[model samples]
Target: MRYVTTAGVIALALGLSACGAGGNDSAAANGSPFGDCIITGEAGSSPLNLISDGVVTVKADLPSPGWYNGDTVESIKSGFDYCLLANIAHRGGAKGLNLQNSSFDGLVAGKAGSFDMALNQITITPERESVMDFSDPYYESTAGVLVKKGSTLTQSDLADSHLGVKQGTVGQMLVDKTIKPAKAPAVFPGDAEQQAAVAAGRIDAGIQDLSIVLGASVQSGGKLTVVGQIPTHESYGVMMPKGSANVVAVNKMLKEMKDDGTLDKLNSTYLTEAYGVDPTTIPVWSF
Candidate 1:
């Protein structure tokens, strides 16, 4: 896991703590029952704890099933997840939010009937929209490939190469639907396996989120380099069951966060500040 250092976390925490409640109509001002922000559901319907304190306690799913925090077991921290946490903290302070770890299969299978939110870069699509309520996109992503530094791979030649991607990720979708590799692409179970394959010379390149791949590249000790961004227009959203009670409140908070520049600050703190990758520097390609 290419995670942020302890200093990064501390700095981010302090920065958020210093944020002033600015939006004209905050979640609290909207008369939301859940909290000053969104309400996932009524008491017991979701992980949100209904209490007199008016704080929202939510159980959010991990990036994938069985995934745990790399930095702390008591927390579900990741570069991507950290962005979400930072935004929430900036908007209403951490006191109003409580996050619990869960899995992809659990959320999708309804195993986490009590969980309130599932984020982990979950893309918002019309198909998923039919069964789930999604907040306005918290993050937008583009696919990217990681290759051995100095390697001569390019987007145009990807179709003839053996690319690696996680089995059920959008990277896999990009490879299958767009890149359309000449040879069957090497499918790994997760980022670790796919990254390992790239490092071990088992695969020519690995495809995944540009931000993720860039983080991996920086942590690769010069063994890997990001190829560039693939323009797939992927937007990641926070999800809840269909007709989630908190959708309105959540969307309200999200909109305020966007308008207040909290989202951009979070993006910089986690992605660029921690990983040192300038997203704009990466070239973008269209399928």
Candidate 2:
């Protein structure tokens, strides 16, 4: 499977910044006031601090088992917080907020005044953005096909086979829309479960995030190979209540991270390491 290296990611970040600055300031300025401060549900001890009204509060929202186990969540959170602090230092103050980790349904229902922003691995879709505001994406990845080593399938050889994917994820959507396989099966298992099924010959192939699939493949001693990639162009972003002031603050921080190479570094540390891939070779996704 192809991989990305740190140097390559740094170049991509520079290229993105040169092409366009992220965040829509006009949208943020036209939105709601920044008054309330809270982080409803997050993992571990409160690693966030609010700087407003001459008060600083630290709160914790513990993550569920599934959330805490993934490298993507941790990496994104680190980059988010790092950018946030820089923004606060340069911009005077920000509304403190954190997202609660609940089921997808719980998140969609809203968490009252718990947090002003949520940083889960939320994929941006027109249907979702219609109800909630989404910051510029923090991470971009494509779907990939995982098969046993030495499989005959090439990157384009799986259009007619039975493909497996976790139900309700970008992976599933990519398989449905991009691959349009002849016999796609809905495999609603966890990442580990789906990977295990592929390894055990229960399925011809499994569709998953490139990061997760590559990470698991390395952990299994190269027993699997990613034979195909789906060009669905998925991304993860910060979900905020529509018209929140915090949007500006978050975007500011994100841009700074991009400028200083912090974003690329974080991706290298967590994602590239997990997948045993060099950060420089990660494909660039056009914004």
Clashing pairs in 1: 27-36, 28-36, 39-246
TM-score, candidate number 2: 0.61
TM-score of 1: 0.70
Which regions of candidate 1 deviate over 4 angstroms? Answer: 1-70, 75-98, 103-113
Q: Each model's C-alpha lDDT?
A: 0.55, 0.47
| Best of the candidates, lDDT | 1
Task: Give one digit per residue, the lDDT tens place, for model 2 in 76-103.
Answer: 1223232332233224343322222333
lDDT per residue for candidate 1 within 180-271, as digits (tens), equals 88899987755666787888889999987665576677666788887777877767777777766666656766676666665555445444
Which runs in model 2 stand beyond 4 Å of their true positions? 1-100, 104-115, 278-287
Tell me how candidate 1 scores on lDDT.
0.55
At residue 89, candidate 1 shows an lDDT of 38
The C-alpha TM-scores of every prediction are: 0.70, 0.61
Candidate 1's clash total is 3
Q: How many steric overlaps are in each model, in order?
A: 3, 16
Worst 10-residue stretch by lDDT in candidate 2? 11-20
Worst 10 residues of 1 by lDDT: 10-19
